[model samples]
Target: MDADKMSDLHEEGKNAINAPMLPIGTDIHPEDTLLEENAERIMLDPTSRENLKFKDLLKVLIDWINSELEEERIIVKDLEEDCYDGQVLQKLFEKLSGRKLNVAEVTQSEIGQKQKLQTVLEAVNELLRPHGWTIEWSVDSIHSKNLVAIVYLLVALAMHFQAPIRLPEHVSVQVVVVKKREGILQTALVTKELTSTTEMMLGRFERDAFDTLLDHAPDKLNVVKTSLITFVNKHLNKLNLEVTELESQFADGVYLVLLMGLLEDYFVPLYNFFLTPENFEQKVHNVAFAFELMQDGGLKKPKARPEDVVNLNLKSTLRVLYNLFTNYKNSE
Candidate 1:
């Protein structure tokens, strides 16, 4: 564990776990005499503290899920027990009264999982309330943008450079995320990294940048839209997920993990374009470079040593991307 506190001493300030505790002198000490209304003061690393809280919340949720699964097993057992000699019992009940006893039955439901998650999210929000960060859960707001943004990015930069107008069928149904916020949005690069946003001024910057790009590529903008439609359709065919494009049906952490992993796998450079304004043009060039290197077969050989895809083999990169997304889907 990282040191939560430091004290100037001859030896050292031990971590929070090993902090000095008063010696036990009595069966019931003053500290344990009654409920102490006063809050305890302690040092903490902000990043570690947040991470622990997130883990704690998630652990509780996982435990609850396990309990639910156990309850499901119990339900199945009860069903079996109740149905043991079911025909004999049915006859007995039928003979006992004109109206037969109504059998109590229960079946497992996915709704329980959704309710558990909602309750868990609320608990997480409560835990975060003390902190400045406000947790926000949106269904498909950012999820829809995962791969579709690639086409927009390609179109945005295509005005000045040659970007592939046609991507493979696999590009059609990219893994979409169920975007949530533990804090607030910045450049959207580091999700939930910014906790002190009083307003969405940065969001305006995002809009302006997108508007500027679209304005610059007025003629190709509509073509880009058409291309995005085709791309999304192809992506749907590519992925095995049952969810639709705009549906926020899946509100799960798997989506978040997969989305982050996909961005890391597919093209980190493309994501970096929105992160740095000063280096935006170069980043765009770098993004366009990889797509340019890609051909009908897969990622093509680099044109020159300076090429972005020069050192990276196209086939390996695509395989890793496909495999990672596939694994995430299978995990679900």
Candidate 2:
């Protein structure tokens, strides 16, 4: 072959190979490069970068959510290990999510159990402060557990009172017993049988007189009993003799004086005598004389009225008296 022809063939072969092989950084044409550069510049601009940052933030948030789900799995495992049953776990989950559980949809047993557990926990917290006691309450059923807890607390308080603390006279402590019914709470200082009478008698007395009555020490049982007896008898006698006449005749001051006199003279000493029941009548007469003399000596005037002398409920009155007497006997 001629040299020029051979060289031409070689050049053709080289062109064929080189045509398929692109140079580094020259695969794109100049116009295409310019278009790409424009596209890149648009994408790299401030607004575009901000959009990219937002997209990245959203991805990060998604990842964080996934992580939280994983963490919840671990927490659930721990809860299971801790013996948190399904109902309790569900409640805890709802609480963590800031949502309310569909209690109505839940089984009655589960709802009851949860409520009972909550009540027991509250009771424990309440008793912990004053009694310095710790309780570990666990239950297969919440209602029974809670009822037991309430009974336990009452019994504990009763036991605490058996060895009563000597509180100062000025710092009076009123012992109010509480009972719960249908999720509602009720309180009474004494039994239900005595409640009406106690309330009636307490209401009839002035606030100061009522407070004075409450302040009497436990040592004055006889005085309290006698006073109550006399007060009841006086009202009964007055009611029986001339109910209509006395109702119209007595003034408020006269009623107050009569009540106060009965309390101070008959009640106070009677309470003292009752504390030592062996000398009950002697103490009653002696205190009655002192009371009369004090009134006659101008220390106190008759302040109660006939109108103030209302008829007492005999049944309620006797019931309260019985309670007082029973309490006295129990103390001895």
Candidate 3:
């Protein structure tokens, strides 16, 4: 091979070697993670702990939100419990899910509807505060079809994109959209087969706000939004990074590290819940739901090759993510 190709190979080998395998079920803490050491990276805390138990911690917190939603639903007329349609919200609760919260905000305001909002904000802020994250939510009247609640993730702690190729600053993911129309209130979480599938094979539609957070990714040109495939391809082109190369970089790379860190942190409280047989059964249920839809003429039979599996894996990952909170039987 040419010298240039050889040089590329060497670098790839180095990244592969240096990539960190962050353990699952680790909490995000300022002292526990690279958030302290590297002002430049939104780093991972690699310390492992034993004897962690879930005991339905996630189910409880989720129940709180679900109860709130159930109460509100009687009142957003536009909001429907459509499993395959409606807008997909960002992974706020997932990233925030399964954590311990201080209920101090529960007492902040005793006034009517404001009290419920305060309860959620206080509960979330308390949990995130220690990790250098300040959570904020607002009532959005014009951003969507209904009056919505928008959650903003502010970086209070020193965090960076994953190392090896770290982003200069951390990206704040906007999450947890609550919509109310007429008198009814509902959560917008599900992605659909028709509108949500952006590319025939790439990614799904998250919000354009996510693009603004990434430095190298383009400023979404038109106010008009596009599909996930379009978004991923456009950003990937600008960054000049192939999905395979980025995938191989894994937890060490900037985007994947931050993304995975958030995911793992989100899973901390639900650790045991995942180990439960019900989780897999739910996944299988989700798969069967998906398979039933595939009976349509749109999807072709996939070639059952290892490479094909890889491609399918990428899409499936994105698809699952799109469905993560929205399709959860509990979060409903």
- Leading candidate by TM-score: 2
lDDT of each: 0.29, 0.34, 0.28
| Model 2: residues with Cα > 4 Å off, grouped in runs | 1-112, 133-136, 139-221, 241-332
Writing each residue's lDDT as its tens digit, candidate 1 over 1-332 gives: 33443222312332222333322321222332222333221111233324543334333323322333352442222211222322222322233223343432322343433343333334433533464333333112112122122222222222112121211121111121222122211111112221112113123223332244444767764454344334333433334533332112112212222243243345334443233323434533543433333331253432222222222433222222333343333332
Model 2, position 225: C-alpha lDDT score: 50
TM-score, predicted candidate 1 vs. hidden true structure: 0.15
TM-score to true structure, per model: 0.15, 0.22, 0.21
Q: Quick one: RMSD of model 1?
A: 25.7
lDDT tens digits, residues 1-332, model 3? 99999987886576445444333543334332222222221221222111121112222223333433463342222221210011111122222253433333222232422433344445555655665543433321112222112312211111111101111122222122223332222222221111112121112222323334332444542221234333333334443643433222221223322222233233222332221224334433333333223323233322111221223343333332233222222321
User: For residues 1-332, what per-residue lDDT tens digits would candidate 2 score against the true structure?
Assistant: 99999987886575455434332222222322233221311011123223443334333323322333454543322221222223443433343345554443334575564664454445434544565543423343223322222223322332232211111111111223233333222333321111123233233434333234444544554455565555444543542522232222222123323333443343433332222223434433333343344455355321221111212322322332333333333221
lDDT of 1 at 263: 34
In terms of lDDT, the poorest run of 10 residues in model 2 is 163-172
